[model samples]
Target: MSSSANNAVSSPFQLFDRTEWKRLNGHFSYHLSQDEVDNLHALNEPLNIKEIEDIYFPLAHLINIFIERTKDAHAVVNGFLNKHTQRLPFIIGIAGSVAVGKSTTARVLQKVLSMLPGKPRVDLVTTDGFLYPNKVLNERNILNRKGFPESYDTKLLLNFLSAMKSGVEEIQVPVYSHLEYDILENHMQDVVRPDILIVEGINVLQVNSSKGNIVFVSDYFDYSIYVDADEKDIMDWYVSRFESLRATSFQNPESYFHRYAGMDPQESLAMATNIWNEINRPNLQENILPTRYRADLILEKGSHHFVKQIKVRKI
Candidate 1:
C-alpha cells in the first residue's frame, strides 16, 4: 500500500462490504447497527451489509450535510436579495426500478436521519399517492403499467412538491392504497412542512416540459438519489417479494390483491416474472434507469443486494 498505489483511481463500480464501508466518498454519513439496518431491511428484504455500508450510510450522511448547507445558502441569498430568509424543507428524491429496494432506502433514511443532530422533522411522501385512480389506469389500458410516470397526475404532484418546498406551513398529499392499488380519492394526508422532505417512487425524479405540459417534479429537489442494482437480481427479488406477499399480504381476505393468493406457486411465479419482464424491466431499462446519471448520487447494489459502488456527482 504505497502512497501512490493507495491513491490510485478506483472504478465507481467497486463492490463494498461492511468492513470496506468506511472508505466510501461522501461529504457526510453515519453508521447503523446490523440490527437496525436489518429492521429497516425487512421492509426491503434480501438486502445485505454491502448495501448498508456502501449504499445507505454514505448516502444518508451526504444528504444530512447538504440539508444543513442548503439552509445556510438560502439564508444568505435571502439576506442579500432583501427577501424573507424563511426556508422550506429540503427535498430528496429516491428513484429506482420496482423491487430494487427504493422503499427500504427511503425508510432507512427517514429513520437514521431522524436521529441526526437537528432532529430535523422528516416528512416522506411516496409518489404512489399521486397516481391516477385505478379507473383511469384501466381506461388508459395501462393497469399493468401503473408505475409508469404517465399514470400519475403530474401537474398535481409537481404542484404539491412545489408548495411543500415554498415554505408553506402545511400541505395535503393524497393517500394511496396498496390494497386497492389506487389513489383513494378525497383521502388526503396533511403534513406540516418539515425540515426535510423525502419523495420516493419509480419516477419521483421525472422532469419534462413539452407538449404544452410544464410539469417538472425534480425541479424542487435539493438533492436526489438513485438506487442501483443488476436487472437480473432485481427481477429475482421482485419475484421473491411476490411469493412473500402471496403467503402473507395477499392472503388477507379483504386484500385488493387477494386474487393472487390461491394460485399455485408456479402460476404465481409466472405471473410475477411475466409482469417484471413485460412491464417493470422495460421501464427500468428505458426510463427509470436512464435517470440514474441525473442523480446527485448513485448507489450501485451488488448481486447480494449490498451497496457496492457509490457514484457521487462532482461538485
Candidate 2:
C-alpha cells in the first residue's frame, strides 16, 4: 500500500504489438491455404491469411514448444519414479465473451496445431455441449441465463475432463445444437485419445465456488487463452452476428429462433440490443471479464475484429 510497494507492482504479461509478435514467427514454415482459412472463420468474424500468418502461426509455434517440453518433462518424471506411462493429452482452454471470436481462434489453432511437425491428433470441443438441456433450464427458471456458469452440468464436465486427463482411450461428450438452441439428446461427440484437445467456451475460465467445488474447469488446461476486446465492441459484434443469423439460420422452421426471421432490420436490431443489454452484458461484466487476466495468453482485438496485440503471461 506504500509508494515503493506500488512501484514494485508490475504486469504479469509481456505485451507485444502486431509487428513485434509477427517477428516471433521465426523459422516456422507452416501456412494454410486461403480456402482453408476461409472455412475456419466464424460468422461475423473476419479471418484472412494475413491474420493467420501474423498472429496464429507464431502462436502455433509457441504451443509446439510447450508440447515438446511437456513430453520431455513427463519422461523425466517417469524416469525419476522408475515407472513408464503414456503422455496425457495437452489441453488448451480458450475463454471469452460471446461474439469475441474465441470459437474462430480455437478452430484455427486446432487446424494449425494438427499441421505441426508430426501432424498431432488435435481435437476441439466447445463447452456449449456441457450446458444443461433447455428443458432443465426452463424447469429451473434460468433459461435466460443459459450461458452463465450454473447453467452447465459441471459435475459431468469435470468427470469428462478427469477421464481424458487420466488417459482414457475414449470419451463421449454430449452435443449441443445451435440451430435448436438446445442439447441434442441422441447426439454425442467422441473424443478418442487426442494428442491435443482445445476446449473453447465463455465459461471456461470461470471459478464458481458456490457449489463447494474445489476443482475448476480450467484446472485441466495446460495452456489457456482469453480473447479480449472492449465491452462496447463486443456488444456491437454480438448484435451484428445476431442479425446475420436471423437472416440465415433463423429462417429454418425448426430453428429455435425461427420467429425472428420475419422481423424487420430495425426490429431485429432492437431485439438483439435488448438481449445483449439484458443478458450477455451482465454475464460478461460479472463472470467472463473478471477471468481474462487468468489466461496464459491474451489476444486483444480491434473493432474490426483483427487481433492488434498479444499478451504472453510471464513464466
Candidate 3:
C-alpha cells in the first residue's frame, strides 16, 4: 500500500505513547494491593502495581465515563418514549490473539471498575466456555482447530449475549476446563445481574461471514479493547507460556496435555513452535488481528509484555 493509503487507514485512532497516555490518568491515584495485583496477573504476563497504575487505572476511568454517558442517553430515550426501560448491563468485550495478555486485562479491569465510586458489580465470562465440547469437535474432525472461530457455537454465544442484554436476572453458562481441555459435561454456572459484564476471548470481535451477514459479537459491546503485540513478541510469549503450562497444568494426571509434561525441552519447544505456526498464527492473521480495527481502544504491548502504546479510536 502507498504511504498515503496507510495514513488514511491509520486515521481512525489517535496513537499515544506510554508517557502521553499516562498524562490522561489525572490525579486520582488508588492503588491495588500486592495480593490483588498478583491474583489478576496471568502466567507469563508479568504485571506489577506500577503497570496497573500506568495503564489500567486510566482505562478504567475512561470506561466509567462511557458507562455514565450511556446511562444518561438511556434516560433521555426513556423520557422521549414516556416509558421506563429496564437497565441493562454495560458490556465490554476484550479481544486479541491468544497469549496477548487479554485475560489479565479483563481481570484487572473488572477489579478496578468494581472499586469505582458507584462500585459497579462487575463479572467476567470468557468465550472459551462457548467452544464446542471436545466430543463434538472430534465428531466434526476439527479438534485440531479448537481455537479457531469455526470451533465455537456462535449461535449459543449470541443467545447468551441476547439474554444478558434483555435484562435477564440470571442465565446459566457452560464452564470450560483448561486442564481437561474441554467443556465440562452437565456443568453450568449461574450469572446474576451485574452492572458491568466483560466478555473476553480471541473470537469476541469476529464478524459473521456466512449468509452475507455482517453482524459481530462486538456489535453488542458498549466498548471493546484489543490487546496487540508484534507477531514475534506474541510467538515468544506463546511458547514461553506453553512451557510454563506444561510444567504446571499439564502435570495433572487427568490433563489432556499430560503426555507433553515429560517431553524433552527441545521437543517441547519444537511442538510449541509447530502449534504456533500451524494453529495460532493462522487464526490471528485471518481472524483475530483483522478485528482490531473494530475496537474502541487498542493496548499495544512491547518487549517483556509491557504495554508501550494506547490507541484510542477517534470519533
Candidate 4:
C-alpha cells in the first residue's frame, strides 16, 4: 500500500483524553452518592465519586443517547410498517481481561443508567453464568480453561440473547457462584422485560472460530465497551485481588478455593502469579485482547486503576 493510502486509512475509533472525555457529559443531571459508588466497587478496584463523575457519567450519558436513538428508530420502523411492535431491550456488552475492573464498570453503568429520566429498569448479567457447569467442563477436559471461549455454552447463550431481543416477557438465566466456583444447581435469575440489559464477562467479545460458529455473543450487543490496561498492571491487579480473596472469600469452607486460604501471604502471591501466568494471562493474550478493537468504546486504565483515556468508535 502507498504511504498516502496508509495515511488515509484512519482508525475506527476517535481517541479522547481524560479531560476531553469528561467534558462530554453535557447536561447530565443525575448524581450518585459516595456510598452508592462504594457499594458498586469491586474488590481491588478503587472507585470514587470523582472517577464516576469523570469517566462513567459521560459514558452513561452517551449510552442514553444511543438508547434514545434506538427507541426512535424502532418507532420509525413501526410507523413505516403501519403496525405496533414491541421494542426490544437495549443490550450492552462489557468485555475485558479478568481483574480489569469490568464488573465494577458494568455495575456502575447500570446504576447510572437506571437513574436516567423516566427511571429505566436496567438489569446486569454476566457471561460467567453461561459457562458450562463444572461437571460438564471436567467431562470435556476443559475444567482448567473455565474462562476461555470454549468453556461457554455458546448455543444456549445465543438462544438467551435471541429470546431477549424477541421481547420474551420473562427469561430465566442460570446463576454461577463464585464462592462455589460452579453453576448453582437449578438456580436461575428471571430477567423480566428490562428496558436495558448489561452483559459483562471476559469472554463476551470472543469469536469461536474453532467451533465454526457463525453468530457471536457480541452480535447481540447494541453497544459494547472494553476495559483495557497494560498487561503488567492487570497482572499486578489480579495478584492483589487474589490475595484479598484469600483473606476473605477463600476462607469460607464452602469456597472452591478454600485450600488457598491457609497459605501465607508470600505463598498466596506465588500461587496467584502462577495461575495468572499459566491460565489467565494466556487466555487474555490469545482470546480477549485480540477482541479489544471490536468494542464501540474502550476505557484504558492507569496503574492506579483509574481510567486515563477513552476511545469512542467513530459513527
Pairs clashing in candidate 3? none
Q: Quantify all predictions' global Cα lDDT against the true fold.
A: 0.79, 0.94, 0.91, 0.93
Which numbered prediction scores highest in lDDT against the true structure? 2
Candidate 2 lDDT over residue span 1-315, tens digit each: 988666446778888999999999886667677889889999999999999889999999998899999999999999999999999999999999999999899999999889898899999999999999999999999999999988999889889999989999899999999999999998999999899999999999888987788999899999999999999999999999999999999999999999999999999999999999999999999999999999999999999999999999989
lDDT of 2: 0.94
The local lDDT score (0 to 100) that residue 223 gets in candidate 1 is 90
lDDT of 1 by residue, 1-315 (tens): 777556445433333454555565354445667787677765446655655555566666767678779878988999899998578788889999998888888888887677777678898889999888889889989887888767888888878887886678898989998877778877998888688888999887666443465657788888988998988999998999898889888998878999999988999999999989989998888778878877887777787776666666766
What TM-score would every model get versus the actual structure?
0.86, 0.97, 0.96, 0.97
Stretches of model 3 off by over 4 angstroms after superposition: 1-10
- List model 3 lDDT by residue over 281-303, tens digit each: 99999989999989999999997
Distance from true location, Cα of 201 in model 1, Å:
0.7
Q: What lDDT, from 0 to 1, does candidate 4 have?
A: 0.93
Arranged by lDDT, best first: 2, 4, 3, 1
- Please tell me which model should have the higher TM-score, number 2 or number 3: 2
1-315: candidate 4 lDDT, tens digit per residue: 988667546778888998999998997766677788889999989998889889888998999999999999999999999989999999999999999999999999999899898899999999999999999999999999999888998898999999999889898999999999999998999999999999999988888878888989899999999999999999999999999999999999999999999999999999999999999999999999999999999999999999999989989
Worst 10 residues of 2 by lDDT: 2-11
Error of 2 at 110 (Å): 0.3
TM-score of 2: 0.97
